[model samples]
Target: EAGVAQSPRYKIIEKRQSVAFWCNPISGHATLYWYQQILGQGPKLLIQFQNNGVVDDSQLPKDRFSAERLKGVDSTLKIQPAKLEDSAVYLCASSLDRIDEQFFGPGTRLTVL
Candidate 1:
């Protein structure tokens, strides 16, 4: 079982710019996760989904950040009008379920200037 795969390992953009990230979870995984990890801080759960239905997303910034998992498979996360505070490593993870061990991607490093 290989780790999840994310594209464009690094991204740099000005404040207010928009960016989208793609994630492909491991095969047969029933749960997917998105997290934001700022410098010096632990990864924060942005959203979680179980088989295409949102399980939890209270920590997500709904005003500018959105995500979707289609067919309970691949997922995407987008941040519009990116803010300086949004600069962080956006990580994607997956598990058999909420309590299962999570497999994480290397992450997309977003640098907002």
Candidate 2:
């Protein structure tokens, strides 16, 4: 099966600017997740969606970050007034079920200057 897809493989922006990342999960998958991975650290869950409804977003930085999975398929993540700390790899993953194996996208690497 086709894997996850992501856009703008890389991004460079100044602090406080706005940026958005897009993702398309695997077909037939029911669970999608967005994660932020800083250098030398594991990917931290930002948000999780089971189909069109949100399942978990405890780690999402609501102050400047938001996301949506309107159709329960593709999704987008946006950061308005981005912070320097936001300069990291944003990853999108999907699983057939909550306990199933997850497939990850290539990710969007953000750099803040």
Candidate 3:
């Protein structure tokens, strides 16, 4: 099967602007996650969901970042009023369960000016 799919592979926006990313994970994978990978560092989990229900979001900046999984299939992540520090690569991953191995998408790179 093909890998996960993400759109707008690259994006650039000014501070305080809004941006959104889309992802479609492998079919039948129930667990989905969004991550932020800053340059030079490992990816940090932003939010996670299992079949459209949130599993964890403690690391997510709720004030500006939001995410949702539609019908337990596709997912979307958004960042509003972005800040300069928000510039990073946003990745999407999926797994059969919380403890299972995950498949990751190429990611959408965001550059906040």
Candidate 4:
């Protein structure tokens, strides 16, 4: 009955600093996703999780970015040695199934200096 939840709605860091974002998906949802929206650009999928397993992460920069959906309910995304270009809104969404329309949470805005 609850919508998704995210913490620390905003974050500020210098380049090379590390940051982590958290997400709690809606109940009964089976698929979860993380996305990054850079200024002026549409959100790009960063990772997809079906339950506790990874479904897709081809576009994610594994060298600096990583994510996990622990126990198939809540998730976390992290960036190490972050770059200025990493500044963006990090969005979390969930759906009943992979093909279902997703419900999104208010994103976490990260500002890298």
Q: Each candidate's lDDT (Cα)? A: 0.96, 0.96, 0.95, 0.96
Q: Model 2: which residue pairs collide? A: none
RMSD of each: 0.7, 0.6, 0.7, 0.7
Q: What is the TM-score of each candidate against the true structure?
A: 0.97, 0.98, 0.97, 0.97
lDDT value, residue 17 of candidate 4: 94
Candidate 3 global CA lDDT score:
0.95
For candidate 1, give the lDDT. 0.96
The deviation in Å at residue 54 for candidate 2 is 0.7
lDDT of 1 by residue, 1-113 (tens): 77799987999999999999999999999999999999999999999999999999999999999999988999999999899999999999999888999999999999999
For model 4, residues 1-113, the per-residue Cα lDDT tens digits are 89989987999999999999999999989999999999999999999999999999999999999999889999999999999999999999999999999999999999999
Model 4 residue runs over 4 Å out of place are none
Tell me which of candidates 2 and 3 scores higher on lDDT. Answer: 2
Q: Which ranges of candidate 1 are over 4 A from the true structure?
A: none
Which 10 consecutive residues of model 1 have the lowest summed lDDT?
1-10
Prediction 3 TM-score vs. true: 0.97
Q: Which residue pairs show backbone clashes in model 1? A: none
What C-alpha lDDT, on a 0 to 100 scale, does residue 98 get in candidate 4?
96
**Please, what are the lDDT tens digits per residue for candidate 2 over residues 1-113?**
79999998999999989999999999999999999999999999999999989999999989999999999999999999998989999999999989999999999999988
Q: For residues 1-113, could you state the per-residue lDDT of candidate 3 as single tens digits?
A: 98889998999999999999999989889999999999999999999999999999999999999999979999999999899999999999999888999999999999999
